[model samples]
Target chain A: MISDTAVESDTAVETQRGLVEIYSTTKSFHGNTVLKDVSVCVKPGSVTALIGPSGSGKSTLLRCINGLEPIDSGVLKVNGEHVGVVERSDGFYSLNRKKRALQRVSVGLVFQHFNLFDNFTALENVAIAPMQVLKRSKSEAYETARSYLDRVGMLERADHYPSQLSGGQQQRVAIARCLAMKPDVLLFDEPTSALDPELVGEVLDVIRKVSASGKTMVLSTHEIGFARQIADQVVFLDEGRVCEAGPVEQVLDNPREARTQKFLERVFG
Target chain B: MAQHPADLMESINKPRITRKTKTEKTAWIVLAVVAVLIVHTLISNPNFEWATVGRYFFGFPVLKGLLLTIILTIVSMALGTLIGLVLAVLKIMNITPITILVDLYLTFFRGTPILVQLIFWFNIAALFPDLFLGIPFTDIGWGINVNAIMTPLVAAVIGLSLNEGAYTAENIRGGFLSVGKGQLEAADSLGFSEWTKITRIIIPQSLPTIIPATGNRLIGMFKETTLVSVLGVADLLQSVQLIYSRNYETIPLLIVACLWYLIITLALSYPQKKIEDRYSKHKNSGGKVTATTEGVKLG
Candidate 1:
């Protein structure tokens, strides 16, 4: 166990694997319903791919579970903790504005746009969150960041800005950025769809490596091949509903719903 | 060497790639005409009292005017920039009824003439001489010096700053918004608090926009500072006015102030334009592309 593996620190200790439970989650933006009666549980150490056409509520579902997008009516539980936005039935959310802010730190989301701070180099982007938000020591954060970056094959590009990297490289850094947080669940909102045709695979390789590491991941992706390869469960989304879902092979390849069948026929063709 | 006369002639007649814009051509032509008219007028007018114009520059009254103008410009521009920064933050946060009121304040100040605001603030003491700023529904009061605060220079700074603040707020808000809604989410997902996101993430990303907007404010503030002379701030323009009025050499005395303003504007224009170009460089094709962390690998 001590074969030049260095020391396990606080971040290694803070990783608490937990289950996510959702019941009848619904969300809307400015009176337009984006997700309705959507229910899905992302179990610990499983890859769940939320697949759908554009505006099919895949991203919205991910957004709602993390409390990034406020839901109209829903009960979402992450690590057995309710990720509720407004006043709770037991009055937990009504603590104050400061507490509400504290609640947002638990869920980690990797945006499709890579949203890496362009001004900060890739390493600083990963480094700042741990050092500041988690109050981790600078050396500790940097050490974890280096490991995360090395895992994503971005340890060399740490000093480069987001602007200087290719699309594939940026998303890899984004994965490292999220992994640095060591959250209960890591949500990916169309992580690979925005990438160039050629660059998608390189980023997908990093995600697959992450999958093999047993990190719980909920990805919204257009890369059907990657989903079939990695996702334990594939939820086919259409018209803001879970049209069909099961194992990746069952749902993506041989879907039950007519909408899903039609979607893949078009997508696969 | 091999009878390339036709090709050389074609290259010579090739339409200019970096052709002068309509505005550039117009500016050049207008400048040339104005220069010609000035030279022609000077040549024909032998009896013009040019020496009197030089004489007004040395007078004590004109010196006071010059001092006032410089002071007004410095004070108004400084106050305006600070007010603008505060207003920008307030506008970007959750919009309440009070925010709407602030929006209205911005619109009214930006819409109206600066001269009018200067006059109104200067004369506000006539409407409410007893001013107080303290907790509501309490006898404990804080009296304010109405006359001291209402001095023309003070009023000018207040008016310019308040009015300019609104525009600055819009500029700052624009910069904040340009950082993209997704960028804020990225910051939040990273566990950055609201203030941290704005200062560290949002502000840094929006700098390309903020820089040019602030530069615009710098130039606008410079010009708007002259408006304070309406309240007897003795800014450069007002100083020029007093001198030209006392003496009959109106054109040349006004030209002195004009030359100074021109020089200052020209000096600022190059750097401002350069900064604007630098911020916009990313938009051009040559620079490296930045993708949002949404898993997109933008070229």
Candidate 2:
């Protein structure tokens, strides 16, 4: 279906800037193919939610998109530039560590377990990357960090370390940390999965605000309701394949694939 | 409405009661008695030659020797730490040839005894009479006379630092490993260069694990400096030996040296503990509170 759309709208692809384009990407660990020929296109300033069961390749697809995990075959590009690999005259060549790291500057990722730097306070956690990676002045980075922390409603607790904050607060700070980087694309892999049930809403609310700000985002989530509320497009995966892809209503409410239907029914029930 | 809620709350809010263990009192008494006995022995024993200890404790020669010992400890530890950090980073980088080289260095330095190392370093002039100080594989540098430069003091510093570097490297490597894999992934996602990631993230986060172990190594290093006395470098112990050999007051001068070591060790321990406490504060208070006053609700 994605290839069919690509064929139909080849001209449209050129105009779309700062978009994530994953075409027939295959990733495997050992003998197990975790992501099999997955194609996901995240348009500029839009949220695409990937919903699937555990071990259904949602996380793997997100990781591959950000170049955190290398794909076995196929092209994975963020903001129209290849991530983790470069195309040569002969074939695709995996980039060296330094070049790959430079390519990752355009993309950001939020993990399920909020991986905030424990040694730094919440504000420093958000600010350090901008200062170090972007070569921003300390004051400029801190100001940007304060603004993002305010956006996440964590401004007052900016002085606290990750250990002192609850799971929900840590995730909010993690989101703010990613935002401070000012990447063209953001990927969230089950951002709320490791959070306590009651704490999930605060993080989701912050994400909802981010989505409204019109940043390009791709999130793999188990929260069906939250995904439906925020995502412009929804992609459903089953056993390493994208089973269905369309508008949120079509995928969540009127899924055509039997697998997506079964999965949604089980999730909704 | 039989009783007021305030009274009921007061009744339940009494101070916590804990039973005192009878064995603790017994142990305290035993400890006090043992301490008194030791003090009495030190004061009353004529063999101690307390006057001689006092006379030489602050003597010029002893003070000079003490200064050298302190210098050796500080210089060797600082050099060793620098070497350890470089080696640890190289090991983490995992370039096969460099790793093997680091492994060989660690094995040679740590496997041999310090005494032997000191002696060997003092005699290194025998093996290499002259050393070059410039570009390798080409005659582009000045030649250094090994015999002229390799003094007892230099040999002691080199021997102690090399051995300490091996141990410090292991400690620092453990510290780096103690950091969670998640931290590195987060840094990677932010497009941090390898140097930035290690310097800004890995090193800072590993401090809580590194600081306490490094403190232990530091205190050990202070005591280990005494071993250099055998090389006749006139450190604290060597000074005491010189005096005792002249005056025939071995036990008294030895007591003086022992007293100075104890006092300095105690002094070093205080700051070591303070640094360890500062670094590990987060670990102690983690999960004890929430970001907001909603802590009560969360509970």
| Best candidate (score: TM-score) | 2
TM-score of 2: 0.86
lDDT of 2 by residue, A103-148 (tens): 7877789999999877678998899888888889888999999999
Q: Which portions of model 1 show Cα errors greater than 4 Å?
A: A1-17, A29-32, A86-97, A137-139, A252-266, B1-35, B46-48, B55-64, B132-142, B283-299
What are the per-model DockQ values?
A: 0.35, 0.41
List, residue by residue over A153-262, the lDDT tens digit for candidate 1: 99999878777899899999999998898877888899887888999889889889988988788999888888889999999888788788788888976778888888
In terms of lDDT, the best-performing candidate is 2
Q: TM-scores across all candidates?
A: 0.83, 0.86
Predicted candidate 2 versus true structure: per-residue lDDT over B1-299, tens digit per residue? 35569978787778999876899989999999999999999889999998999999999999998999999999999999999999999988878999999999999998999989999999999999998899999989999999999999999999999999999999999989988899899999888888887877777667677778888898899899999998899999999999999999999999889988899899989998887776566456662122211211100
Q: A13, model 1: CA deviation in Å?
A: 16
- Native contacts recovered by candidate 2, as a share? 0.65
Report residue B298 deviation for candidate 1 (angstroms): 26
lDDT of 2 at A260: 91
At residue A262, what lDDT does model 2 achieve?
93
